[model samples]
Target: MRDLYEVLQIGREASAEEIKKAYRKLARRFHPDVNPHDPEAERKFREIQEAYAVLSDDDKRSQYDRFGTVDEGESAARQAHARWAGGRSRVNVSFGGFGGFPDLGDLFGDLFRGGGPVSQAPETPAEAAVELDFVDAMRGTAVVVALRREVECEACRGSGHTSEKVCGRCRGSGRLIHTDRVRVRIPAGVADGDRVRAAVRTTPGGEVAVAVKVRPHPFFERRGDDIHTTVPISFAEAYLGAEIEVGTIWGPVRAKIPPGTQSGQRFRLRGKGVRSVRTGIPGDHFYAVQIAVPRVVTPGGRDLVRRVGELYGVDPRSGLPLGLT
Candidate 1:
C-alpha cells in the first residue's frame, strides 16, 4: 500500500482544504486527457484519485492515519495498537515447554508452500463509495451501485499471453476495466459520514467492498442515535399548552407543549429517534421549542394585544439598562 500523504505530497498535519487543493492540482496535471500519450500518467491519475478518496473523508482518514490502511476498519486500529504495545512492552517467551517454536523461515515456508513471502494476487477485492439519502439511511435500505473496477482478463486468464503474443483484449495488461453492480445495504441509524462495508461477489475474482455514505438531513441533526430538531410554535401555543404534531423519522407524532413553555425548551420523545447499530434500541427524539413572534398583526389582533398589555400593567423592559428621557 502506498502512503496516502506521500502520494499527495502532503504532510500528516495537512488540513482537509490543503489535501483537496493538492489533489485537484495533481489530478489536472496527470489527467489522461492532458497527458494523452502517457499511459503511466493515466495510471498515476487513478492512484491520485484513490489517495484523495481515503484522505478526504474524516473517518477514513483517521483510520488510515492510525492503522496505515483503511481496509480493515476499526480492527486495523486495534491491531496497530497491539503491535505498538508489543514493541514497547516486550515479554520473554517460554517456548521450551511448547515443543520449541518452529523456525521463522520454516513457518513461512509452510504457510506459503515456499520460502518466499505470500503475495496477494491482482484479483484482490476493491472498495467503492455509495451515497444514500438521509431518510433511506434512517430506515435500512438496499441499493445497487455501479462500480468501475479492475478485473482479471478472461482472454489470457490474467496472464496477458496468447501463444507468446500479448493478449489483444487487455493489451499485455493482466487486468481490464469492468463494471460491477453490487447491492449495498445501509443499516438503520447510520449517521452521516459513517461507513458500511458490503461484499461484492464476482466470478473468477475476489469480493469487492462497498462503502456506504449517508447524506445529511436538511432539518434533523443526529447526535449518536438521538435526533435533534427545532419546532416553531406561536406565542399563544407557548403560553397556553396545546397538542401539536411533530415530524419524526418514523412519522408525525403529537406532542403536548406545556403551559409557560419558553423558547429553546427541549422536549424528548422516547423511542422515536434512530436505532442503535449495535443494540438495536431506538433512541429518543429531542425537539426544541422556538417561539416565533408575529411580525405583523391585524387590527383586531393589535387591539387585543393592546388590551392585554393594559390589563397586565407590567413593564417588560423594566430590567433593561436603557433609559427613556
Candidate 2:
C-alpha cells in the first residue's frame, strides 16, 4: 500500500491545511465525473479517498505514523476488552502481551506429546454489517446489531470436564455460543467499508466490529467529503440572472444563477457539504448548471427565440476548426 502522505502528494510532516489543499486539488483533477470512462483516474481517486480517510483523522493518522496502519476498529476493540477484563471478567484474552498466552511452538509441541490439556484458543472477533442511508452516514447515528459470541461454560468453569467426566453443559468444548444485541455508534462522514467497534457485555473480553455500508443517493453523489449534483435551470433562468433553490445534503439553499450561465458550468457552495467526522470541518458542495430547453415551441415563442438569437452577432461555434489537429 502507498503511504497516505505519498498518496496525497504531501510530506509526512505536512500540516492539516496543506494536506487538505493537496487532497482537494488532486480530487478535482482526478474526479470520476471529470474523467469519466478512465479507470486509472477512478483508481487514483479511490486511493485519494482512502488516504484522506485515515490521514485526516488525528487518531488514525497517529496510528498510521507509528504502525503503518489505521486499524482503529481493532484498537478500539482491544481497549474495550481491556476495560471489560478489569471488571468482573475472570478470563482475559490478551492480543500482544508477554502474559497473554504460551509460546505457539511449545503449545503445539505439548499438544502432540499429550503432556496435558491444551488451552482453548481466544474467540475470534465477531462481525456485524450495518446499512445506512447516505444522509445518515453523513450525520452519524447509533444502531443495534445482533452478535453471536462464544462464552466460557459456567458448569465446568471453562475446563471442559467436571470430576474427571466431560461436562454435559458445553459438550466438552468448555465454550457456549450465545447471541446478544449490541449497539454501536457510527461516526459521521464514514464511507462504505468503515468499521466501528462495540463491546460484548455477555462475553469476557469480547467485541463486535460493525462494518458500514452506505446506500447511494438518488441525486446527491459523494466524492470524499464533498457532495456533487447537477441542477437544471430553465432557459429564462439561464438567460436572466435569478436566485434558484439548489438541493443539498442538508436541504435546499438559495443559489444564484448568473445571467448567461452556460450548461455544464459548475458552482461551489462553501461549507455546505459533509462535515468531517474527524476534524469537524465542513466540505464544499459543487453543482453543475444544466440549461433545460422547452420541448414544444409556439409560433410566437419561435419568433421570440429568433429575436433572442439576433442578440448573438456571431455564431457560437465560429471559432471551431473543421480539420483535426
On lDDT, the candidate that comes out on top is 2
Residue-level lDDT of model 1, residues 239-269, one tens digit each, is 7898999999889999999988889999999
So what's the TM-score on candidate 1? 0.54
Question: What residue pairs clash in candidate 2, if any at all?
Answer: none
Task: Please list the residue runs of candidate 2 whose C-alpha ends up more than 4 Å from where it truly belongs after superposition.
Answer: 1-125, 153-174, 199-207, 321-323
lDDT (Cα, tens digit) per residue for candidate 2, span 33-131: 434456887778767766776777788889889999877634543443354245323322222112221211111122122234433645545667888
Please give the lDDT score for candidate 2.
0.70
CA lDDT, candidate 2, residue 298:
97
Stretches of candidate 1 off by over 4 Å are 1-125, 146-149, 158-166, 201-209, 310-325
Q: Lowest summed lDDT over 10 consecutive residues: which window, candidate 1?
A: 95-104
The candidate that achieves the highest TM-score relative to the unseen native structure: 2
